[model samples]
Structure formats: structure tokens, C-alpha cells
Target chain A: MKFGVVTFPGSNGDYDSYAAVRFAMKEKVEFLWHKSEDLQGCDAVILPGGFAHGDYLRAGAIARFSPIMKHVIKFAKSGGIVIGFCNGFQVLTESGLLPGALLRNNHLRFNSKFIYIRVERTDTPFTGVCRKGEVLKIPIAHGEGNYYNFESDVRKLEDNGQVLFRYADASGNASAAANPNGSINNIAGIVSAEGNVLGMMPHPERAVEDIIGSSDGLKVFESVLNYCISPKPVGRL
Target chain B: MTTTAKTKKVIVYVRLKDGVLDPQGVTIQKALGQMGYPDFVSVRSGKFFELEIDAGASDIDRQINEVCSKLLANPVIERFSVEKI
Candidate 1:
């Protein structure tokens, strides 16, 4: 399956995501320009990281209105596969493709480090290859990764099993200390209600190679590829 | 009758919804406490935007409302108020 990595004007992680799919995953990949309103017939779309439109007003407020985003939103609503990482996650939430909002880190500082996140649910296409509760080491770099939502929406997300990843310790305990950005319930990643769209703060694409430290992130990419190869009805979450 | 276009200003205020955590505001409150201003009641941070529009723009209120809801504030955690200034 071909992967489309979107490149907004200020997107710095576009190349990284492209390399991960083209070289690491050995898959056909193309760069989708933000101003273009086309998906380029890709099976999956990746809204890679970086400060789009200079992150003015909010991290993703401007980029969410990009021309390509209109198509991205339509594509996602039609049950297409979309994964957003870092600033990409912010855009997804701002675009209403994902639930909740990302606020400034509780400590009001930009955090950059390798953190462990446990797969909360393996039913989604993004985590299909991982065992339930398995811990994956990934890097998170952001200033506003703190996730927030209305109390009722949080309950709905939990009930629907949409919460997919939570920051955790090596032992897989999602303790308060392990919560990197103080996301409610340590939520590091989540899938849309339909389970076709995923938004996560951590850069799984940055962790695909062992030489870079850990290859735990490759599992996520592989799971998506596997799901694409054999299309099946996804469990609503 | 001939009408000339005039410039009008609209002010928009955006704030996080109640119960939503405001880390920047919290940090400011903490700093205030450290500065020996313990009596400070509270602090909540917010943002605003000033827009200039044509005075004769049709459905000006509706246009401002749409902009506020669609871009100025994120409905999930923020609320926005618009006023013709």
C-alpha cells in the first residue's frame, strides 16, 4: 500500500516520515503538499510533524484550514486510514477528526525525550500487531501535548475503547510519574470512534530503526500495512 | 440610494472552557505566589483577535460567528465571544 506523507509549508518531519516509509518500511511513499487538495491515490495518509503555518494562534489552528486538509478530513470521514503524529496530532484534533484538545504541557515546558507507552487496545488497525498492554519505547517532542476533553467525552472515549496508548513505565504501569505531558489518564495516543484514524503525540516513525535505539515503533507501521493488505471490517470504537 | 463601504472592527475573546486546565495560567499564579502575593484570588489566561471588516458586509454577525466557531476557538476545550468594537 502506498503511504502519503503530507508536507505543510513549515513541516519539518515530512522527510523523516517519508524516509521511514520509503527506506525503513520499504513501501511506496509520496509527499502530499498541503496546498494540494488531493490524496494522490494513497492507501494511507500521514500528517507528519512540524510547526505548520508557523503554529500561529495555536499549534494547528492555521494548518487545519489548509487546502489539503479539506480533502484529508473528507478522506478520513469516508473510513480512510490516517495517522497524525506530534503537530499532526494537534491538527487532527483541531480539525475535529480526533477527539479532545492538546494544551500546553502542565509544566509549561517543551519536553523532548524517549518515553515508554503501553498499547492500551490492540483491536485498532494501528496496534493490531502489538499485544495488549505491551510497552513500546518512543520519543515525544512537544510543548503542548497535554490532552484535555470534557468529562463526558472522556468517559465516552473510555467506554468506546478509543484510547489506544498510555504513557507507562517499563513494567507497563501507567503511573502519574510516567505521564510525560500530564495527559488525562496518561493518554499518549487515541483512535477515532470508527478506529480508522489515529492521532498520537509520540513519533513512532522516528523509532522504526534499531540503530536509532529501539524498533518498537515499527510494529505500528507494520500493523497498518497488514490491515491494508487484508481489508476487514474494523471494530467500531 | 448609494452606500459607501466603511471599515468596522470586531473583537473576539477566546478562553478555555471551565474545568479545562490552563497550564500557562497556573504557572503565572505560581509565580505570583512566589513573589509574596498570596492574596491573589485567581488567574485565567485567554486570547483575543481584532478583525476589520466592511461595515456593509452582509450577515456580518453570521460571518463573525462562523469564524469564531470554525477557527478562533476550538469547540472541544475553548469558548469564544464576539463583539463589534
Candidate 2:
């Protein structure tokens, strides 16, 4: 399947995402400029990590208003596959495509390191290839990855199984110590209620090559491919 | 008679929701205590934006409110107040 990686003005991870899909997954991919509204008929779209608009006002706040986001938002509502990582995830939350907000890190420091995240669910398109409770070692780099939402909304997210991943230890235990940014309930990633959109803090694109560190991130792309070939009926199209 | 639109200055204050944790604020409060200001008790950090709007614009209040909610502050974790001053 073809994938589209969006490149905002300050996007530094766009090339990484493009390389991951083009080389690692052997899939067709293109860079979609933030000023362009066309998606180029891509089956899936990836909002790669970076300090878009210099993370002004707030992380991902200005990037959410990019011209291309209008089409991306529309595509997601139509059940298109969209995955956002790092600053991309922040944009998703800011755009209201996903619930909650990402705040400054609890420690008031920029964190950049490999962290373990347990796959909480495998039913969604983004995690179809992942085993439930499987822990993937991925790199997270951001100063504002602390996720937060109203207690009631968080409870609803949990009840709906919208939470797809959580910060976890090597043994897959979702504990406070494993929490990288003090996200509520150690939430590392989550999918929309419709299950077509996903937002995560970790940099899966940066983990696709074993030479760099680990190849576990390849599963995320593979899972999207698997879903495209045989999409299961979702609640809403 | 033709009248030109006048620019009106407005300020918007954005703060983290009451129940939301503010790590920066906490860190500042800690630093204050270490700096010999023990009676400070607590601190909350926030930001404000000054906007220049056209006074003759229709539905000025609604527009300002919309911008404040949609861009100035994230409603999920932030609260915003607008002032005409």
C-alpha cells in the first residue's frame, strides 16, 4: 500500500518515515507538503515527528492549522488510515481528531531515549500484527509528551478500548517507573473511537532499522499493510 | 460619510485547567521555596496573548471567543479568558 508522510516546515522526521516505508516495508511512499492539500491517493498517512512551526504557542498547535490538515482530517473521518507520532500525535490531539492534550513533561526536561511500550490491543488496523501485551522497545523524544484528559473522558477511552499502547517495563508491566513523561495511566498510544486514526508518542519510524537500534517498529508498517489487504468491518466507515 | 475600521486591542489569558497538573508551575514553586520564599505556598503559571482586531468587525465578541477557544487555548486542559483592554 502507498503511504504519505507529511512534511511541515520544521518537520525533521519526514525523511525517516519515508525511508522506513520505502526501504524497510518496500512500499510506495511520498512526502506531502504541509501547504498542499492533496494526499496523492495514499492509502495510509503518517504524520512524522518534529518541531513543527518551531512548536510555537504549544507543541503541534500551529501545525494543526496547516492547509493539508484539512484534507487529513477529512480523510480520517472517512475511515482513512492515519498514524501520528511525537509532534504528529500532538497535532492530532490539538485538531480534535483525537481526545486529550499533551502537556509539558512532568520533570520539566526534554527526554530522548528508548522506552518500552506494551501493545494494549491488537484489534485496530495499526496494531493488527502486534500480539496483545507485547512490549516494543522504541525511541521517544519530546519535551511535551505528557498526555492528559478529563477523568471522565479517560475512563470512556479505557472502556472503549481506544487505548492501544502504554508505557511498560521490560516485563510488560505498566508501572509508574516505566512512564516516560507521566502520561495519564502510562498511555503511550491511542486510537480513535472509529479505530481508523492512531496517535502515539514513540518514534516507530526511527526504530525500523536494526542497524540503528531495533527493527521492532517494522511491525507497525506491516500491520497497516495487513489491514489494507483484508480490512475487517469497523463500526463506522 | 465613510468611516474606516479602527483596530481594537484585546488580551487573552490562558491557564491550565484547575484540576490539571502544571509541572512548570510546580518547578517554579519549588525554586521559589529554595530561594528563601517559603511563604509563597503555591504557584500557577499561565500566558497571555494580545490580539489586534478590527473594531468594526461584525460579531467581534464571538470571533474573539472562537479564536481564544480554538487556538489560544486547548479546551481539554486549558481555560481562557478574554479582556477588552
Candidate 3:
């Protein structure tokens, strides 16, 4: 199947993401520019990370209005596979494609580190390869990476199983230091109501290659390809 | 002859609490520090703004509160209040 990786003006991970998908799944991947209204005959869309629009207004505020995002929204609404990382996650939230918002790091500083994410659920295409409580070491790079939302929203996420990843220590215990930016409920990722749209603060592309030092991210792409290759029920995460 | 006094414009600003990272503000402050001699001790940042709504004394206060909550400030990590000065 053909995978579409969307590129915004300031995208830094478009190539990394494309290479990861192809290497991990041997899938035909294409680059869709932010201005393109069409996704160019692709089955899935990946919104990679970077400082789009220099993150001027808000992290994902400006890019959410990009033309390509319009198509992305349409694509996801029609049961298409959509995954966003870091800034891409910000865009998803800003577009209202997902719930919650990413505020600045609670420590009031930029964070660049490898954070272990304890998988809350792995039934979605994004995490299908892993089981519940599966641990992943993905790198996070952003000042506004703290995930925040209302208490009602948190309860809804818990009830609906929309929450996907939570920051954790090696022990898999949720703590403030492990939480990194003090995300509410230690959230590191989430998905939309339909479960097709997945957004996470960690960069799977950056983790796909062991050369950069980790391959835990490969499972996410692998799972997507696995679903496309075979037919499986998409589950909530 | 006396002219009606021009109504003074009051402005209010809002943003994240002190413990939050303001990346944009940091970048701007760094640029400022790089220009030449650096004497600015600390740089805390927030939004700048103005309001021109015409309403009763109580109504104006209520409208400001509404606007801040609805648009100006994100309730999650921000603390907001208004000033008339």
C-alpha cells in the first residue's frame, strides 16, 4: 500500500518518517506538501514533526490551517489511517481532530531527551504490534510538549480508551520526573474517537533506526502495514 | 467651549503561569541579548492587548471575563485577569 507523508514548510522529519515507513514495512511512501489539497492516491497519512511556521502563533496553531491539513481531516474522517508526531500532534489538536492541547513544558524549558512511554493500550493500528504496558524509548524534542486537558476530557478519554501513551520511568511507574513536561495524567499520546487518528509527543521516526539508537518505533509502522496487508479489526487505544 | 472627554482605552494581557516555558519569549529575549550590551536581568513574558467594548460598568467586566476565558487565555495552564490602567 502507498503511504503519504505530509510535509509542512518547516518540517524536519519528513525524510526520516518516509524512510522509517519504507524500511520498516517496505511500503510505497510519498511526500505530500502542506499546500497540496490532494493526498495523491495514498492509503495512509503521516504528519511528521518540525517547527512549522516557526511555531510562531502556537506550536501547531498556524500549521493546523494548512491546506494539506484540510485534506488530512477529510481523509481521517473517511476511515483513513492518520498518525501525527510531536508538532504533528500539536496540529491534530489545534485542528480539533483530537482532544486536549499541548502546553509548554511544566518546567518552563525546552526538553530534549529519551522518554520511556508505557503503552496504555495497543489495539490501534499505531500500537497494534505491542501489548498493553509495552515499553518504548522514544525521543522528545519540544518546549511545548506537555499534554493538557480538562478533567471531564480526561475522564472521557479513560472511559473511551482514547488515551494511548503515558510517560513513565523504567519501572513503569508514572511520576512527575517521568512525566517530563507534567502532562495531565502523564499523557504522552492519544487518538481520536474513531481510533484512526493517532498523535503522540514522542518521535517514532527518530526511533525507527538503531543507528540513531532505537527501533521501538518500527512497530508502529509495522502494525499499520500489517493491517493493510491483512485484514484486522481496528481497536481502541 | 468644552469638548466631551475622550474615553480612555484600557488594555489587559494574559499568558501562561510562571512555571511554564514560553519558547517564543525565550527566543525573542535571546535576540535582544545578542544585539549588544546585556543588562536586562530577567525576562518574563506574556501577551499584550487592548479592549474597546462599550458596555455598562458591570457588563464591561463580565465581557472581559468572557473574552479571556473563551479566546485570550487557555484555561489549562494560564492565569488571567484584567486591568483598566
Candidate 4:
């Protein structure tokens, strides 16, 4: 399926996302500028990581008002596929397409390193190719990766199986030590209530090739392709 | 007769909700303790914005409130107060 990677001002990871889709996944992909209101008839969209609009006011706050986002929001609400990584994740939360918010790391330091995350659920389109409880080594680079939400909302996300990935050890233990950013419940990634939009702090695009580090992230893209090609009734499994 | 709209300056103060965690505020509090200000038991960091709006516009208060809630602050984890000077 064709993918549209949006490039907002100061978006540094757009190229990485585009290359991952075009070269690694061997899928048709195009760059959607922030000002462009068109989706270009793409099957899926990716909001790559970066300090959009210089992260003014707040991360993703300004970017959410961009012209392209109006269409993206409508596309997502209509059951279209949209995946956001890092700052893109922040954008998703700010746009109200996803629940919860990303906050400053409890340590007040920027973290950039490889970390392990366990697949909490594989029923969603984003993780269909991942095995239940499978741990993937992925790198996270962000200062405001700490995720926060109301206690009641978090419970709803958990009850509905919206929590898709969590910081974990190699053995698939979702322990506090494994959580690099102090996200509530070690949540590294989560899907929307409808399971069409995914917001994750980890940079899976950077891990698509083994030369960089691990190829486990490819499974995420593969999962999307699998679901789009022949979508099954996606519900809590 | 054409009339000019009056310009009013409004201030918006934004703070994290009472129970939400504020890591920057915690770090500042730690530094304050180290610097011998033990009496400063708490530090909750926040930000403010100054806006100039058309005072003659209809429902000026409502407009300011809308901007504060929709842009200046995220209602999920923050609360905001508006002051018209």
C-alpha cells in the first residue's frame, strides 16, 4: 500500500520514514508537505519525528493546526491508517486523534539509546505481524517521551486493549527499570480506541535495517501491509 | 462613520493540573534545596502568554477563553487563567 509521510517544518525524520517505506518496505511513498491539504490518495500516512514548528508553545501543539492535519484528522476518523513516531506521536495526542499526553522525562534529561519494548497486543493493524509478548530492540530519542493520562482514561485504554506496546526487558518483563522515560504503565506505544491510529515514542523507522541496529522494526511495517492487503475484523482478541 | 476597534492586552497563565507530574518543577525544587532555600518546599513550573485582541469584537471574553483552552493550554494536563489588564 502507498504511504504518505508528512514533513512539517523542522521535521528531521521525514527522510528516514520515506526511505524506510520506499527502500526497506519496497512500497510507494511520497512526502506530504505541512501546508498541503491533500493526502494524495495514499493508503496510509506517517507523521515522522521532529520538532514541528520548532516545537513552539508545546511539542506538536502548533503542528496540529497545520492545513494538512485537517485532512489527516478526517482520514484517520474514517478508519484510515495513520502511524506517528516520536514527535509525530506528540502530534497525534495534541490533535485529539489519540488519548493521553507526553510529558517531560522524570529525570529531566534527553534520552537517546536502544531500548527493548514488548508487544502488548498483536491484534491491532500496527502489530499484527508481531507475536504476543515479543520483545523488540528499538531506539528511543526524545526528552518528552514520558506519557501521562488520567487514571480513569488509562484504565479504559487497558480494558479496551488500546495499550499496544510497553517498555520491557528482553524477557518481556514490563518493569520500571525497563521504562526509560517514566511513561505511566511503561506504555511505549498505544493505538486509538478504533485501532486505526497508532502513536509510539520509539523510532521504528530507524531500525528497519540490520546495519543500523536491529531489523525487528520491519515487523511493524509488515504488519500494516498485511492488514491493508486483507484486513480482518480487528477487535479485542 | 468608520470606527476603529480597541486593542486590549490579555494575559494567560498556564499550569499543570494539581495532580499531574511536573519534572522540571521537581528539578528546580531540588536545586533550590541545595542552594539553602529549604523553606521552598514546592515548585510548580508554568508559562504565560500576552495577547492583544480586539476589544470591540463580540464576546471578547469568550474568544480569549477559547484561545487559552484550545491553544495556550492543553486541558488534559493543564489549567489556565486569563487576566484582562
Least accurate 10 contiguous residues by lDDT in model 2 chain A? A228-237
Residue A195 lDDT, candidate 1, scale 0-100: 93
Off by over 4 Å in 1: B1-5
- Give me the runs in candidate 2 sitting further than 4 Å from their true place: A234-237, B1-5
What is candidate 4's TM-score against the reference? 0.97
What DockQ class does candidate 3 belong to?
incorrect
Scored against the true structure, residue B47 in model 3 reaches a CA lDDT of 82
Candidate ranking (DockQ, best to worst): 2, 4, 1, 3
Q: List candidate 4 segments past 4 Å from native.
A: B1-5
lDDT of each residue in A14-44, candidate 1, tens digit only: 9989988889999999999999978999999
**Could you give candidate 4's fraction of true interface contacts?**
0.84
| Candidate 3 lDDT | 0.82
Candidate 1: clashing residue pairs, number: 0
RMSD of each: 2.6, 2.7, 6.8, 2.5
- On the 0 to 100 scale, the lDDT of residue A102 in model 1 is 94
Query: lDDT of model 3 at residue A40?
Result: 97
For all candidates in order, the CA lDDT equals 0.91, 0.91, 0.82, 0.93
lDDT of 1 by residue, B1-85 (tens): 2323587888899998988888888888888999999887678999988888889789988999999998888888889988776
lDDT of 3 by residue, A78-192 (tens): 9898899998998888778888789878667888888899988877877778989988988998888888777788899989998888999987887887888878889999989
Alpha carbon deviation, residue A142, candidate 3 (Å): 1.2
Number of the top lDDT candidate: 4
lDDT of 1 at B80: 95
